[model samples]
Target chain A: MNALALGLRRARFETAVYFRQGDTVFFTFLFPVVMLTIFSVAFSSAGNFGTKPDGSGGITAAAFYLPGMIAAGILLSGVQNLAVDIAVERGDGTLKRLAGTPLPVLSYFVGKFLQVLATSALQIVLLLLVARIAFQVALPADASKWLTFVWVYLLGITTSAVLGIALSRVPRTGKSATAVIVPMVLVLQFISGVYLSFSQLPSWLQSFASVFPLKWLAQGMRSVFLPSTFETLEPGGSWDAAGTAAVLGVWLVVGVVAARLTFRWIRKDS
Target chain B: MSETEHVSVRDLRKTYGAFDAVDGISFDIGRGETFALLGPNGAGKSTTIEILEGYRDRTSGDVTVLGQDPGRAGRDWRGRIGMVLQSSGESGNVGVRELIAHFATFYPNPRDVDETIAAVGLTEKAGTRIRALSGGQRRRVDVALGVIGRPELLFLDEPTTGFDPEARHEFWSLIRLLKREGTTILLTTHYLDEAAQLGDRAGVVVGGRLVALGPVDEIGGQDSRIPVVRWVDAAGQREQRTTEPTALVAELHRSTGGEVRSLEVIRPSLEDVYLDLVAKHDSTATPTGVLA
Candidate 1:
């Protein structure tokens, strides 16, 4: 079989295993949804974000936080989950077994990419449904907004997955994989505006976050889910679509290069 | 190279800094032959196997597996060989059948998934998660995956390390079945009996060198396998190493002119000969730092 065909077969197997595990489902797929719920409920009585500059309407805390949750979901599904998963696989001999096989290294990564894409899609759908039903958050109705969401999501997920593959070698052993990766991801979540408004963060913090992909992902998601009137609240006083695309595009290139350099089917010292 | 040679290695050496993990080893495995590599811990068995499997590169050697240098072999070369590692059930979250089926796609010609599972005696556990299975069952899953590719050559690295007696016997039968189908096997095992039962020929490695290589029963030579005639009489304990133990015992009985007390014949088994070989090698060689 060709690499693509073999990869898709592996992807099917990975997707099944990914969804069946209780820890993976709770941590990767549902963590963002649960956190979003808690944040929306905790701040529900605080009222909406003032009024729209264009006199359009009011946006509740839940509505404002939906895009952040979606962005965070993408990060968790791609980066945090994969970094830990690949490290565990490497330490447990999964990569060694595959290395002994005829499967191409590119095919193995293809399997991972497709698995992340499938799980992330499902996770985002679940998050969206929960936000819509429980918090009554409005869904984006414009086709253009959905198109923006798709592109940003594709770029953000590609960057996260590749970076995750590269970062898998950071942990020396499987037991410490979550310990090493979780803290890094959590720090990125806080600094990238997943848990706080980007404009409300200090200018220095915003500048620091701007160097990473999560910040651009969250900003792009905001542009998709939030109204145009909310654009004035951004640090640049507008939704910089081109800026988000450029930053994400650069990170994607960086991630691909890093993954190519660092990814190994077997440990070198072994 | 012989037309029947499945694997050929000459002067194979793997060096880590100044230490030679595998120092000047040479061997050939014929097609459809089961060759067992026996060694104590850190005796370079794993290093040699890894070099042959292409998982590790040798610092110096001429090596070939299935007519190609394993260090430079491509995916097509990989497809012709299979390996069952020391550990088992890596994809624990996946079902047995599913994982086996997934691996089957990597080979140009793969065995039927269910048939392979059955061959390993895992038919009943096909739907079970590998992690949920017992250690022996998980090992069977490992064997299932190894044979699913229908490999021309299979590497079994301590394949029965944790098996119970019954499971080991069953695994031996499974290996015999694969052998019957003409799979050239390279097996490394600590169990002397396992090697004796399955190997057509055996090689003993010590301190990164091949100390003995021959047919399994003849590894230590005629001197080592000689039967010992032991008896008790007026001369307090007596023993003699002899090829004709029956005649020696009769002569002793006639000389004593009565029933000999505590009379018995001892035939040296492979384990005894192996321990003797290792001890002799250990005493003669100068001490070196741990190589593992």
Candidate 2:
């Protein structure tokens, strides 16, 4: 089979396994939505960021949390999921078996990339639906805003997935994959404006988080969902679309290079 | 090497720093022949097999599989070879048939998934998750996946380690079926009877070297195959190793001029010769390499 067909086949295989595991389903896909629901309920009466034109209510906690959750969802399904999954594959000898087969290395990555895309798409949709119907959060109102969302989403996930593949080598064994990966992902979520407002974080922390992609991803996502007036709340008092693009773009290249250097079908010491 | 040889290894050596895992071992396996590599736990069998499978890089050596250097072989080369690792924790969440069918697509031509499952006696558990199966059943799944690609050459690395006696018999029959289909197989096993039953030829590895290589019946040479004549008579207990055990026994009976006490002829089995070979090698203080 050609590379495309083989890659799609592998994607289907990975998706099947991903959905079957209850832990992955809950932690990677459903966790963000669940967190969104809890935050919306907990801060329902806190206040509003801005008021809708209809003046019924302003941007509720769900609206503010929506884009952040979407960004976090991208990271969870992309970097965290792939890192843990690939580490498990290596530990369990799946990579060794595939290495022995006619399967191309490019096709294997294609499978992982596509699986992340599919799962991330589902996660984003679920988060959007919950925010829209359950919590009355508004989506992007124009095609231009959506176009921005599209590029950001693609670049963010591609970078995250590559970094995850690169990070798979860090854990010595599959059983310790989550212990090694979750803490790093969680720390990024906190400082990257996923769990808090970027403008509210200390400038030092913002600068530290700026070096990573999650902060920029969340910022780019806010540009899509939030009204233009809300850009003033950003760290730079604007969305800085060029900055987000540049940072994520550089990380994408870096991630691909790192993955190439670190990825192994089997462990080195073995 | 001849054109019929599927695998050729010349002076293959794999070293980890100061220790040599496989030290200057050389052997060749012909097409459609079942060659067993018999050894103790740390006897460099897995290292040699991994080198042939292209799973590990050798420190220095010449090794080829399917007419290509496995170290530099491409996907096309990998497609012709199927590997069942010593212990594979694969297919934990996937169904037996599903994983088999998925792997089948990786080859140019693959066997029918259901047929391959049946060959491994996993038809009943085809829909069951691989992790849900018993140890032996899971091993059958490993075999199923290995053969699903219709490989020309198969590597069975201690394939039946966790099998029950009945499952081992079933596995042996499956191997026989594959051999009948003209698949060249390189098998590594600690089970001497398994090697004797399935192997056309066997190589006895000891101390990171190919100590003996020949047909199963002929391995360990004439000295190893010598029969023992034992008799408890006037000398109390006496045992002698000789090629002519029948003549020795007749002489004992005639010299006694009566019925001999505890007189018996003991022939050495493959296991006996293998044990003797390993023991002999161990006693020589050859500085055996430590296996991983």
10 residues in a row with least lDDT, candidate 1 chain A: A261-270
Please name the candidate that would achieve the greatest lDDT relative to the true structure.
2
Clashes of 1: 0
- Residue by residue across A121-232, what tens digits does model 2's lDDT show? 9999999989989997877779999999999999899999999998998999998999999999999999999888788899999999999999999999999998787887
Q: Alpha-carbon interface RMSD of model 2?
A: 2.0
TM-score of chain A of each: 0.95, 0.95
Give all TM-scores, in the order shown.
0.95, 0.95
Clashes of each: 0, 0
The digit string of per-residue lDDT tens for model 1 on B125-234 reads 88988889998788888888888899999999999887899889989998998899999999999998999999999999998999999999999888888887777877
* DockQ for all candidate structures vs. native: 0.66, 0.64
Model 1 clashing residue pairs (backbone): none
Model 1: residue A70 alpha-carbon error in angstroms: 0.7
Residue B74 shift from truth in candidate 1, angstroms: 1.3
